[model samples]
Target: MKLQESTMHQNELINLNEYLLTKGFELSEEEIAKLVHVQKEICKNLKWIELDESKLYKIILPYTLSPYLSFDNKMITLENAILIYYKIRSMFDWHLDDETCITTCFKTYTSLYGIQDKELIKTIIIGLKKEGYNNNANDFNESF
Candidate 1:
């Protein structure tokens, strides 16, 4: 995976929270604590923290989002986008126990969002083609 530099911001956090709310994924106190602890460590480390997909799934266990999407034709939903954002965000440096960490988080969020957007557009085109809307799919593909 390519790592693009991004700055985390308050709006990104707000957007993630809103997305989670829509998905009915509210973090428990314990989960919040764990998130904070992990985030602090990431920030303090100031380097990439290794987190494979399984560890990523465990970190986001509070959410109902599944981590087992098939690679070839995987779809990126809001949940996937948010989680991917966090996973990347966890690898960067930031301020511990402060909202200032938003900068690092925002960076990861935007990068992941770009990747996910491309995935989504490709998925949509595939769906359109499968539904026999070849013309529409071709038009959409051209738009990208």
Candidate 2:
């Protein structure tokens, strides 16, 4: 998917760590490195990275975040807006990693939080619908 903003979002990722601090956890660079290493190792074990089959999972830049949520039928509820944004960014792994599969991750992950951020979610829902994802934008709020 095309990022609306042009910046690398490094500063935004740093800001996410600060917000995560209040959520009872700290996102450390060391931890992030380890996580990526582990992820890479797992990819290797699955033969997805070094082997063939188009390497379904791709690795690119790394970011971190923590997420929390709540919901009702009328409006989705979130514990923290900032947290969700951060989580969304990290979950965007498959999105930012490659152009072709970007939409796939974005569409599949919209409701992964179990709670939708009305504004941002509205944008994504519409975007996914336009891209032809199988999800009905209006029906999403039904699970809110």
Please provide, for model 1 over 42-95, each residue's C-alpha lDDT reduced to its tens digit, 9 standing for 90 to 100: 445545454342333333332333333222322233344334344333322342
* Model 1 Cα RMSD, 1 decimal: 15.5
Best by TM-score: 2
TM-score per prediction, in order, is 0.26, 0.32
Name the TM-score of candidate 2.
0.32
TM-score: model 1 vs. ground truth: 0.26
Clashes of each: 8, 1
The lDDT for every candidate, in the order shown, is 0.37, 0.37
C-alpha-based local distance difference test score of model 2: 0.37
Residues 39-80, model 2: lDDT tens digits: 455555445443322121121211122133211221122122
